[model samples]
Target: MISVKNVTLRRGVKVVLDQASVTFAPGEKVGLVGRNGAGKSSFFALLNGSIHEDSGEFSIPPQWRMAQVAQDMPETTQSATEFVVEGDTVLQAARAEVAAAEASDDGMAMAHAYTALYDAGEHDAPARAQALILGLGFSVAELDQPVNSFSGGWRMRLQLARALMCPSDLLLLDEPTNHLDLDALVWLEAWLKRYAGTMIVISHDREFLDAVTQVTVHVDNARLVRYGGNYSKFEDMRAEQMALQTAALAKQADKIAHLQKFIDRFKAKASKARQAQSRVKALERMEKIAPVLADAEFSFEFKEPQNVPNPMLSMLGASFGYPAPEDAVAGTPPTVIVKGINRSVLAGQRIGILGANGQGKSTLVKTVAHALTPIAGEISEGKGLNIGYFAQQELDVLDPEASPLLHMQRLAHDLPAHLRAGQGTGEQTLRTYLGTFNFGGDMVKQAVGTMSGGEKARLVLAMIVWQRPNLLLLDEPTNHLDLATREALGVALNEFEGTVMLVSHDRALLRSVCDEFWLVSKGGVEPFEGDLDDYQQFLLDEARSQREAAAASQRKR
Candidate 1:
């Protein structure tokens, strides 16, 4: 078991954690939850010895091994496989010693090295490494790829894979699913459920936390509160606590009012004077219970345009793909991923694009946004049509050195001549736009680079709203947003009067916002008329049919 007692942590003058105490038993899976800056990461840092608390006692078993998957990666020039192997530094050193001993002919040195390596479990190192790498979704070919060649998301996965490879009695994971796709996330959920050791995971994904954790540890009001069962249970418990507090406050208020009336009526009489004085003292000494502040509830309202024309956009016989390097001419026929695809977007159409990763979802969005040229197709636009494109990595477009307000200013200045006239040109306009997206005065002045991923996503969304486009193209807009933000975006889309085309993996968001579905399969696209739930059922039935067909093929073979 691991235990913490009387822990107090402060950053400069502000206390992040005060007298927080918690315990984790063997085989316990706990989910840590709080608001964005509620010291979730700092708490993990304290446990990993990366930071020290003002006052605390943390105890763990003497023989216990610990591993942590951090948000940031260490700078290193190593391959992915080499990086995971290096996680067990002691074992690696032992193997190195064994190698050196075998090279030497001296019997005495060889015997000592063999004994040390055996004690460190050097004989089984290769098997352990292979199991861990495979479990974390790394193929043998991918294991040899250099870490520097991977993107930020892949680097995070590498860090998690390395942490899992190490033998540990206690595991600390912070937002492990931030970079994982659906398949990898499902695998991780199963792995953690079957793990024998204790785990503390900090995540904002409700479904993920519900699947893997058995308990919840909530940090609120600079204190720690433990709840039995998963996130859903904790939410119910919190609601009950609030209800009880409300009732107790009401009863106390009634008693206080009765005492006040008695004092007002009997204070003038000498016989009742003593009793009235006592009542006054009791009132003064009573501790008033403050009502709990409500959690922020987001309700988004999109600014609807007055009138939008039909046939907002259309593509005729469109073909999209990258240029073939084998062709000598630059303008030669491009290799087509999709061809003879004719589609139209009418006003008030909420279309969702679905396919496996790398099957050109992003590419299709780019083609619609005019970022990519259609090799053999004609794209037609209706009159008075305005378009807003929200790229999956739209937050990365912000200038690191610029403040949010300054970024807004740059966008305003770049508007077309027809749209730039008669608009207010002050910081107040920018501040109002920022406030609409939940970024207040001081936060609007902060550098965009300093904001968290969720904050950056909000900033991108705020900028998009400023354009007030009639048609919105969102490519995985829920990627970095939390549950509240995702829901907020969904509400906005639902209220939007214009056409919307989105690509998202969040079932809840898609179900709430979209009214139609588009399935992008092998070299073709199909339109289906139904809500998200119907589409999901169709997908499952199709998958079942394919599985049965594969089984039949195998029998014939």
Candidate 2:
């Protein structure tokens, strides 16, 4: 068990936690939730002993082992499997002991070292590491790749796998689903559900919290408030508590009014003066209950398109991939991941593109958005077609050094002459446009590089909508956004008058905004027959098949 007693914490002059207390029993699954700057990360740091509280005490069992995902991306030449296997400190130490025993030619030491190896499960460590890596979304072939060969996002997934590989009594995960696709998210949910240790996770994904957490811990008003159930249940309970508090305040106010009325009438008469003085004292001693402040609510919408063109874009026998090396001569083949992609995106079509990571989902989106050229075949466009694209890597569309207002200025300046008409050149016009995305006054002048990921995402949305494009290609647009902002984006997309093709792991957004689904798998694109739930089951079956195949190959060897 772990206990926090009257803890006070501070960062600089800001008081993050004031007299907060909470307790966690063994094997309890708790969901930590709050606004972005509510000191959730600081609380995690305190539990890990990297931070000391300003006052009070926090205690955890000294004998219990802990595991948490590292935030730093590792730069190493080690193979992915070896890196993850090294997470089990006991297994690694035992293997080293066996090596040393053999080198020293000590039979007694060798016997003890071999025994330790067996106890540590050294023989099955590789298989265990492989299982974790595969479950977190790595291909069998990529298992042998060097750690440095993977991208930043994939490297984070490796870090998560390494953390899960550790033998621990307590597990801490902070935003573990940020980098995962829907398939891997589902797999992780299942894995965490079966974990035998105490787990505390911080996440903004409500559906994931509802599926995995048994309790909810809310960080609000510089204090920790514990609730009895998951996120939805907590919301319901919180609503009831606030309603009851409001009623109590109202009743108190009515009693005070009656007492004051009596005191005013009787204070003038000498006979009832004693009773009036008693009422005065009672009113003076009464404690006033403060009204509850409501949580901030955010909402916004996209401007209607300037034109709606039928069949906005179409592809015939198209191949999507990267171009050959610069040194290669003419006719050097391009590396194609998806081929024979014949599809037409009509006006107002809402399509959700689904696929595992590295299976060419982003490539297809880039191709349709004209960010990349199709290596073969034709991609025809309609008359007056306007494309608004949101890249998964926000840096692709944002200039880090520029301010939000400047980005809008560039967009206004770059528009075609006829389209630019009536759009004002004044700074007020730019500020007004950005304000809808929550960038007010001083925020409009802040540098994009210094802003948070959610702010950068909002800036990107503001830029995209300013042009009034007839088609939108959004890839993982909700990655940096919080739940409220994500809901706002979904509302805007649902009300949008243009065609949309979105690639996101946010199942809520996908289910709410998308009406049709396209599956990109095994180097081909096809239509899917069902909803998000059906797609989740398909992924489970696929993972099971791969596991069986790997086992068969291992037996053959």
What TM-score, over all chains together, does every model reach? 0.75, 0.87
TM-score of model 2 (CA atoms): 0.87
Over 1-557, each residue of candidate 2 has an lDDT whose tens digit, in order, gives 99999999999899999999999999999999888889999999998888999999889999999999999999999999999999987787898999999999999999999999999998778778877888888888888899999999899999999999988899999999998988789889988999999999998787789889999999999999999898767866765675577665574555445434433443332133332233233223221211111223455667777788899989999999999999999889889999999999999777889988788999999988878899898899998898899998765558888899998898888888756666676799899878888899899999899999988988888888877888999999988988668756765776678999999988767765676789999999998877677788898887777666656655675
lDDT of prediction 2: 0.82
Deviation from native of the Cα of residue 458 in model 1, angstroms: 1.6
lDDT of each: 0.71, 0.82
The numbered model that scores best in lDDT is 2
Candidate 2, run of 10 with poorest lDDT: 285-294
Q: Residue 457's C-alpha lDDT in candidate 1?
A: 86
